[model samples]
Target: MDITAVNALPYEDFVNIFGNVVEKCPIITAAVWSRRPFVSLNALEAAISEFIDDLPESGKEGILRCHPDLAGRDLHSGTLTRESREEQARAGMDALSSGEASRMSRLNEEYKTRFGFPFVICARMNDKANILRQLTERCGNERAVERERGIEEVKKICRLRLQGLVLCDAPNKL
Candidate 1:
């Protein structure tokens, strides 16, 4: 939406337009359109970056929930964007070996049991084997460490996604 149009929107409407991500991730959603207009895309990005930077460690999990579980073959909801799906398909993970498939299932169960959530990664650029390998290793980390690592990884992925969608002039960094 244009800045003028965005500025005119009510607070509730503004939050709704952003897909309710603000409730769960205030850092990424801190930009209030009514108070100020971002002069350029970079300005908008800078606002988002500042918010993400200021978020407390405890708030990271809430933000992570805003991302979809990577290669979540059975997922029917959440932010599994079409572009992410296509990228996984290209990386040859839309199909899985029987062993790899079984491993993913088991890992999913173990991961959920430990974390109370499915393992989430931005699997845009990783191939099947590499993704599986990483998942296997991550499954063994202590809960606190894994949680921190997961948030950092998700932030990296989000930056890459924004680079692709919002920052056309810049190269994708992740």
Candidate 2:
């Protein structure tokens, strides 16, 4: 979509297009709709990042919690959002072997128990191997560090999703 068209979208249409850009957080899209006449796609994305950054710890954690676990039950049950389904497919999450899926499931549960939120990475940016590796490695992190890392990953996912929906000279992809 063109930035001009994006700026012209009614709030509902805008949300319809962008709502799940940050997984299940339509509130974020609703709030940012007021920041319209976005000068560039970058400014639009900045608004999203800024919104996420401004949240208190609990709110930030809430955003993370809304995300489905990579390769978890949502994917198995075909309950994932289209954006999530595509992102997971990009990371080859849809094709994990039974053994690999088993390991990922175990590590994901352990990480959530430790961190109080599911482990999140920009699946579009990393394949299954790296995702598994990071899940294993990041499971060792303290809560604060892991929380921030997950938020940053959320931003990366947001950027990519925005690029897909809004036409612009997207800045270098992360």
* Best lDDT among the predictions, by candidate number: 2
> In candidate 1, what are the lDDT values of residues 53-141, reduced to their tens digit?
67786566666655555546533343445555655567665677777767877887788788755576656657777877888888888
Off by more than 4 A, model 2 = 168-174
- Which lDDT value does model 1 have at 97? 73
List, residue by residue over 85-132, the lDDT tens digit for candidate 2.
Answer: 999998999999999999999999999999999999999999889999
* lDDT scores of the candidates, listed in order: 0.59, 0.92
Stretches of candidate 1 off by over 4 Å are: 1-46, 73-79, 167-174
TM-score of each: 0.65, 0.94
Enumerate residue pairs that collide in model 1.
Answer: none
What would the C-alpha RMSD of candidate 2 be, to one decimal place?
2.6
How many clashing pairs in candidate 2?
0
